[model samples]
Target: MLRWLIGGGREPQGLAEKSALQSIGEDQTQNPYTELLVLKAHHDIVRFLVQLDDFRFASAGDDGLVVVWNAQTGAKLLELSGHTQKITAIVPFPPMESSKENSQLILTASADRTVIVWDYDTGRQVQRSCFQSTVKCLTVLQRLDIWLSGGNDLGVWNRKLDLLCKTSHLSDTGISALVETPRNCVVAAVGKELIIFRVVAPTETLPRWDIVEVKRLLDHQDNILSLINVNDLNFVTGSHVGELIIWDILDWSVQAYELNFWNPSAQLDAQQEIKLCQKLNDISINHFTCDEENIFAAVGRGLYVYNLQMKRVIACQKMAHDSNVLHIAKLPNRQLISCSEDGSVCIWELREKRQLPAEPVPTGFFNMWGFGRVNKQASQPMKKQQEDTTPCFLEPVGDLIGHSSSVEMFLYFEDHGLVTCSADHLIILWKNGEQESGLRSLKLFQKLEENGDLYRAV
Candidate 1:
């Protein structure tokens, strides 16, 4: 019975050959997610999923609603409704040490130009504040016990929702992303520029907290799309034209850079495909995720793994998906998961490629053109070039095909499995089939023994 539940039963005569081909062609031995539970709550698209605790997570999106769920049992715990428009950003706001009770809190920003703090345990809105413009992003500074909001301008607030300091209107286009750095500094991506700001805490001479712009980085040629702090010493940013720049956190200088150009002519010989015109979105860098050593990037419909120490691409899959990938994440055991506009989520593993003794080891791809320290005043743009064959490869292990429209993002809970939210207005909780089967059998045996059925059968 348990084997049948996991699709282990024999197939019909006509379908046997087809099933055998699938099982042999696709290697699913390393993939553990064979069971899933579909969860539906939102009427519109579900865009964001944030983990609130070990066994719980909250999801919010275009429906202008926030729903909390139990990761272990696939149960709906709470439904939070306050925003009049769609939600743009959501983050967990952990409790301080001095608080009376250890209630979990969350912060959500919406297109209605309001930010609300909710206590999800009681399904109550603890605090709410309206802004002059819609807040597109939110980042919490846990060390300073304050949060920052980004939109047309930058604003800082305390846990009590009191405005502490704010910057003057920085850009009409609004800030796209925000990330905190060491020494009380923050980086904001506005249009094509990256602005560095310093936050000054109140002191004896200063009566109020202040935010001052330190520098403006104009390295990117196109609009910045993604920004992330890789570690304490460096941060990375991706642009609309597929240019990836790694910046030093201390001085805000470019450490390494690369332009991921997708040349149509290169694919003509191998695939016999000809593309007359290429759009800006074709090679756009949509998102990035990183581990301790490498940065995984979702560029167009492909995946690229770049090493920070080597400062070069180690491995890449030019066409990992049928459509543009929206989000990617690094999982344990050298595994990676990515979701795309094609409405599919895939699992991949990084494996070292075996080489023959006669073949010489390839050098770094960027060796011809030195890219160590970039000249800020250089007039010429970096030329588009193909990457050399790498020593590693990404092997696809499993596919989760369920969403009909698009899979926006996903969350990986180490023990609770994977939770994915999609543009189809549905969420899926993928569980390990083998682990769940064992748990079910153990429970059944325990119940039978308690009811004396085990002794009677013996």
Candidate 2:
């Protein structure tokens, strides 16, 4: 890899070191390789895995047991045992500030139709909460001392794991995933919809939940895969229809949309087949991430870069890894990191570019015109894609991959490596990127940050 970069006159940065890894825990699930990029023969498959926002790792498996590993060392810090059926999902809680010591705690969901809060450091069960149906997805809001869990039904609980509110069968289909936002933790279910509810402290009231309905979204035509909140007022979501929808949290209408290309195959199809991609229902939005400049989204076959303010598709690259995309996230320095079901983790540099005009007429002035213009946003569109054949910018500049299997989730450590979890039942520590890119996204964002257009546009 280094040789290829050097030959191209691109010096490798310190973060570009080829990855070498060691597995910490063995996966014990059956026929795990039935999945992509995962090495089943070498490890056991834990069904539900999470690298908590705070960097703690938790996973529950077929054994009806849950194990918590320190996100970096992959060391078995604690083991939770109780469920009689397969455990489906697990989430960790941040340490309470008032506690004298940092105690490790997590919420685990199971097929046995119950949810349990375990003290990972001591392997003690803080609370064992149950439901009528199997548990599928779980989310924790430590600051609010509340957690959300759902399966056939959706329920909210206090930090102690007591049922606070129940949206009995929010959808006919089972819940898929849950995420906490400023107002609530939005839950996506098997049906093409989402239920957003405010986190309420346990209290006696009319709704009694203190939790209120934010909205009920039925934007997708089929089952929704994942929901990523870009900000307090906006979110990006993917569905089984291969449609990626970006919406304002406060409004119900769709703001921007793109098709998840490459679901058909890897070979780039130049035959301009104008298909209606307004909705994407490919492999289900497996993972999603967005920085201040770009929204990085992936469903099995897609890697989409949607400009936040521009509201346009910038780069839609297809990575054929023979499996679904497990996770997509942003590094501290803002590079995009992605992992797939095929057992591969990739670091992506958000390359920015401007369209060159059809006529190569060079403008000799310093004024705003042509590619030489200060803002591509202000420049006229090229006559078409083919006539403007030259690449305005091209270079690889970020390095942020560090996983041996399908990295499911990650936690960032400033100035140090990040913590990640993989299907191989191993957690990894990765250094952030050090290389620089010649990509246009780099300088474009730089300009935006420098108030490059504020003085003139404003």
TM-score of each: 0.85, 0.66
- Candidate 1 clash figure, as a count: 0
- Report the C-alpha lDDT of model 1 over 206-290, residue by residue, as the tens digit: 9899999999999988799999999989999999877889999999999998774465224343222213325667778999999
Structure candidate 1, residue pairs in collision: none
lDDT of 1 at 446: 99
Report, for all candidates in order, the number of backbone clashes.
0, 19
> What TM-score does candidate 1 reach?
0.85
TM-score of model 2 vs. true structure: 0.66
lDDT of 1 at 237: 98
- List lDDT for all candidates, in order: 0.84, 0.57
lDDT of 1: 0.84
Candidate 2 error regions (>4 Å): 1-43, 47-56, 59-63, 71-74, 95-103, 181-190, 198-207, 210-215, 260-283, 320-322, 354-458
Give the poorly placed runs of model 1, Cα more than 4 Å off: 1-27, 98-101, 261-277, 359-388
